[model samples]
Target: MKFAPERSSVALFVALTRAVREAPVAEGGRSLAYDVIDRLAKVINTPGFKVELEALIALGAREPVLNSALEPFWQELHMLSSSSSAGSA
Candidate 1:
């Protein structure tokens, strides 16, 4: 698989964060934030998930509602990311 360069990654992250703001709720009825959280939960197992996760966490930290909504998912992904990194190291 091809990895995104850091610049592209950041751009993609920014775009996603913005696009998600007005994202429609999924057909199953979960909020858009929850939908993105669920997708993140999956992608985070793949290579190079760190950059995007970090950007989202940083963005979330600066916004009250996003911070609250994203914190749990961020923590979950962070724990997984930490453990994986430790294992590789």
Candidate 2:
């Protein structure tokens, strides 16, 4: 399996923060759900990224702020999981 370039946890945090912050759920702006799912969709197909994303979600859920940020993406994550599993079968 091919490995992606190593990224620090801090870098991942910063990227997610930027993504979430840029997506304002207000008039004239896209919803948080759309932005979060879009961010995950871009990486979900990359080798090892899905697993890391799941783990990150689990860890993030322990924190209230992170959990709120992640809430909108849960349904999209489930759909991605189902489609990927079917594709692999």
Candidate 3:
């Protein structure tokens, strides 16, 4: 079943958050959390998910790990957006 972008993002965020929170801290909890948040930011930043993405980003999440996790997602998001835009015209 296909999920609406917002719903899919939310689900992904929840799963990532859970994984980060439950993982052993000794294994780098802070960094893990940051990565999860970063990925969440990308998921939310998708074309139809911008508003949610902005809200999530505004929640005071700034960490190097999170930024790193988000790097891949950001690249994917850009590619997706560009491809969709091109397809539209």
Candidate 2 per-residue lDDT, tens place, 1-89, comes to 66446554355445555655654334223244344445555655454446656665754554445556656555555555565556655
CA lDDT scores, all candidates in order: 0.51, 0.52, 0.48
Q: Pairs clashing in candidate 2?
A: none
Name the weakest run of 10 consecutive residues (lDDT summed) in model 2. 24-33
Compose the digit string of candidate 3's lDDT tens values, residues 1-89: 65344435456556556544554444554554555366545654345444444433443254444444444345444444464445555
lDDT by residue (26-74, candidate 1, tens digit) is 4332244445544555565454456556655665555556665444345
Steric clash count of candidate 2 = 0
Using all chains and alpha carbons, the TM-scores for the candidates as numbered come to 0.43, 0.45, 0.33
Alpha-carbon runs more than 4 Å astray in model 1: 1-42, 86-89
2 against 3, candidate with superior lDDT: 2
After superposition, the stretches of candidate 3 with alpha carbons farther than 4 Å from their true spots are: 1-7, 35-39, 46-89
Pairs in steric clash, model 3: 34-66
- For all the candidates, what are their Cα RMSDs to the real structure? 11.7, 12.1, 8.7
